[model samples]
Target: MTQLETAMAILMKTFDTYAAADGNKGSLSKGEAKTMLEKELPGLLKAAKNQAEVDKLLGGLDFNGDSEVDFSEFVVLVAALTCACHGRCKK
Candidate 1:
């Protein structure tokens, strides 16, 4: 599988772990992701140019435009960023 696929798998496993730990079940929603980022990775998201910029970036992964990105879609977005960052790191 590709790097993204692998990363996505890892992300799914992570969500599963979170669910298991919390006694909850099912995939994460877009709002949940935004909350998690705000609470857990505040520094990363604080760099966003503005709410619209952040929303646009989020929109790339919000395939359905429901204003909610599923865990799998979130994984894809994260993995894509990770890959890009890794590339820059290697340069």
Candidate 2:
């Protein structure tokens, strides 16, 4: 696979693990997913201005209106972020 594809695959794996463990990305308690993001995503996203913004961004993707972003939603959001960063791997 190409570099971008490989990056995306690794991202998907992270989402899968988070989903299987937490059910919904948003279901992750405050600082939980954020900590993971810090570790895994690194430069992928700008530092969220506040927890509210983080919640809002994640909430926007929670299609079911549940307070959690599911694996699919997380993937979609990460994909957007990847595109925003011009396909560069953040790690």
Candidate 3:
């Protein structure tokens, strides 16, 4: 697979791994989302100015107000972080 293909696969796998943690094979519960962020994106969490900011970030990810993050929502979070880091690296 190409690099982008591999990255996409990894993203799917990562989301599935976390989302399946609590009997939900297709979406992440709040605790699962928090654990995923704390474990997989610790740098992002650490960069947050405060716990409320982290909470806000998580809250915002639930764009549909479903209280659970599905694959699409998870992708948005990854894409946003990737874009943010890309800009930082280009500076």
Candidate 4:
């Protein structure tokens, strides 16, 4: 697979791995999302100014107000982070 394809597969795998933690394979609960962020995106959390900011960011993930983050919502977070990081790198 090409690099982008490989990345996409990894993203799906990562989401599935975390989303399955609570036996709900369909989406990630709030706890699952927090754990995923803390474990997989440690740097992002560390960069946050405070715990409240991290909480705010996590709260924002449930875009549909469904109290869970599905694959599409998760992808939006990943894409936004990727764009931010890429922009930072080019500076």
Best by TM-score: 4
Which residue pairs come into collision in candidate 2?
A: 26-69
lDDT of 2 by residue, 1-91 (tens): 9998998888777766655554453344334456557677665346676767766765676677765666666777767776777867553
lDDT of model 1, residue 31: 59
* Range of the 10 consecutive residues with the lowest summed lDDT in candidate 1: 18-27
Pairwise lDDT winner, candidates 1 and 4: 4
- For residues 1-91, what per-residue lDDT tens digits would candidate 4 score against the true structure? 9999999999999999999999999899999999999999999999999999999998999999999999999999998888888885342
Q: What residue runs in model 2 are displaced by over 4 Å at the alpha carbon?
A: 1-5, 23-32, 44-46, 87-91
- Quote the lDDT for 1 in model 3: 100
Cα RMSDs, all models = 5.4, 5.4, 2.5, 2.5
lDDT of 1 by residue, 1-91 (tens): 9997996677777666543433445645555555656665576688887888766765677777765666667667666777776885342
- lDDT for position 81 in model 4: 88
Task: Report the lDDT of model 4 for residue 86.
Answer: 82
The collision pairs in model 4 are: none
Best by lDDT: 4
TM-score of 4: 0.93
Better candidate by TM-score, 1 or 2: 2
